[model samples]
Target chain A: MRRMLKLLPIRFLSAALIYLVAGITLGTLDALGYGSFKSVHSHLLAGAFFTLVIMGSMYQLLPTIIGAELKHRSLAEFQFILANLGFISLAYSFLSNYSFLKVAGLIAFISFILFAFEIFATALSVKDFYRRSLAIWFFLAAVVYLVVGSAYALAGVLGITSFSAARHAHILTLGFVAMTNFGGLYELFPMLSLKKLHSRRLGEVHFFIANIAAIGMFLGFPERGNLFILSSLLFLAGFYLFAYNLTRTYFSKSHGPEVEMDISARFMAYALAFGVAGVTAGFTSATLGFPGSFTHVHLILTGWVGLTIVGAMYHIVPMLTWLEKYSTKVGQEGVPLIQDLYNKPLAKALFITLNTTLALFAFSSLLPALSIFAVPLAIAFLVFAVEMLLVLGR
Target chain B: METLDVRGLPHSERPQLILKKLEELGELEILVEVKPVPVITMLESKGYTCEAEQSQGVWRVKIRKKQG
Candidate 1:
């Protein structure tokens, strides 16, 4: 059981990468006009790749941050198995144009319900609620959003509500993905920099505004003009605040020796940059009623979310592997630093290739000639896989 | 009174240095400047007794060998 527990995170992370590969392949195929695998592509990217990474990271971090043992440790394994099974079924349903999507959706929804229940149970049992960190609030909110998003999706599946596809996507993207990533950065940045956060108050403000903006933007829906501009402005404010806070903290005087340029930190910064660019493009697309806004989607999905996940993996995979392997010998033996566990040059190149490819991909929407960049993106993933394997091995 | 200033050390190095110092000191009381919970937890797991307090946003933890 202990061994399984130790191996669980890596397994989930590995699954995320596999889904990422599948998503990229599907995306490339679609771009090349082979076939429009839209459902499978979107689900793999959002449902499989993004969800797996967030779940894996939260599973590893939640107990520590919340200061409580996981309420149902065994359920995590079940959730993982169900998630993969559900993804397979969902993909098959999409590809075959079959009626199995409902079953797949139900299975996936149940897995998250179990996951959310575990978090809620664990969090509620926390003995010192006052001592809870900022990250907990963000994560808890994300869980709530996940539950809500899942319910909304399930409703769509059951033909209950007139839930538009855009609204569903928004809820999942903003509520689940954006909230989780934003909240995670609050915890991750301070730890990586070995510095205190700039201001908890600002973090709270950012959280509040982000949620409000998310709700406003999604609820505005197909009614695009006034509501879209207002919601986007609010969203932009929230984004600016978070970016400012992070920059302040990063540039602040560290209490400890300055941690070197962590590859993950670079990834996070890039994600933030991409996020800003994406939002701006979205705003322009919305305001001008641009017919072709594939660039906006491309930037958000690849440059923002995808890059963020890739960056986080550089830190998370090595950290987990090191703890599992070398923690006991840390002080006793001359163990390598977490950064030393992976090939940095490869990681750096991977980061560059990923962002560059995403940029090229965004342009590919206008100029189909740019489609060739997908080849390098695939090669970059190969580099990523090799680096990750080396991290696990070394 | 033994003092170890971990203020200048990175997160990865703090605990390692703390444990190393504990080993070197061999039962003498030591004061470590660090984030209290994780350090105290780690020390307790290794059979050490600890007390911690925060002042001016800095946490100082005192560690000692658990007396039989």
Candidate 2:
């Protein structure tokens, strides 16, 4: 049961590493006095942390979800080491402003490309609609976007692009990372909640539309306002449909949904809505410019992306660990459910406080008066750390 | 004596797993209609009621009576 706990550190390692790096970077960038080191952190979070976690979960997820023997276990085994090494080098490069990160990115890019090829071959080998469709849709979209986005960033690194390098960062973060994770969510979440999904049609709809929107917006930015607007609308619409279906799944189930779902799934639903708000604001707020851009990234990262990852962790951790065996055993024998393993009150407080702090951080002019917001957000992380430790049984 | 076809088995799953699960629970001789990968070819050769076929990643199996 506890074997899956190893996957925990791998996932949380990235999460914590991201913030730790971001905090240092932000402290360094405080001289600017407006936005922090978000521009840099966006790339790090999307490329390194998000990339690592998604790959890890997919290893855990693809086989279980699709009921297929992993195509090459040896390759899967090596992928973890290769990816993390590349990520570490890339992060170091970013911090040191070294050319080596490009080399690291190249290594990581090769790993990703190979990973994508393996997933494609593995999926095509499957004979089931649910499994194959999910594998195909999931790996294909995730890999394609990630590859292109990474290639673009790598091009920037090679000094080929005329634009600011940050543009590539945006494409990688928003286009590749977010699109991939969100697509996986549609397949993963309903199963976690023990409810039937609304429609595979809607699933495909969300997948294609969001990808098209992201790709179109990326390619057409600054020159094609109409295209960007249309793309943003499609992205928002896809999210809305996804959230709606997830909500229905959680609520529709007769076997009262798990505490994990209650906390994570519902939070993610809010995050999706928050994402819509953030994107729409960016579309309309040329007055805000870069800040508006950061706002959108924050919403997707902290709101939608962060919420989903956290919620998914709660479910995936226990499911893979075989901890659910204890619950089912306890249930049949008239014992309590697995609620004892978690601290709900602490999480609730973190949710409320963190949500408020992020909102203030993004939408408010109160930084002058409420300059103390960082303390609470930091406190929220403290609480999160505690709960996370409890989940890990630390 | 006759074969009946069932629909709505999502188009991508392995037909054998479906058939096996159904065969485990149901009381009928497994008959093949159509499938991409048929599980038991010997049954088909014996002129058993079941047969399978595959089209566009979808498999359908049918069941009928033996010829005598």
Candidate 2 per-residue lDDT, tens place, A272-385, comes to: 666666666655553335455545655667666766666665555433332323322322354323344566787677778877876765543324444345556555655564
lDDT of 1 by residue, A1-394 (tens): 2342357678788888788878878977887789998889888888788898898888767765654556787898888998898888888888988579789888888988888987778877877543556777778888888888878878888888776778878888878888888878887766666566788899999989988888888778867657767987898888788888988887888775566856777788788788888877777788875525687777777787777788778877876665566656755778877667787777877888888887886767678888788788767875686567567777
Model 2 interface CAPRI class: incorrect
Q: After superposition, how far is residue A287 of candidate 2 from its true place, in Å?
A: 8.8
* Candidate with best TM-score: 1
Best model number under lDDT: 1
Tell me the TM-score of model 1: 0.87
Q: Evaluated on chain B only, what are the TM-scores of all the candidate structures, in order?
A: 0.79, 0.32
Model 2, DockQ value?
0.04
Fnat per predicted structure, each in turn: 0.24, 0.00
Give lDDT: candidate 2, residue A5: 37
**RMSD of each predicted structure:** 3.4, 9.1
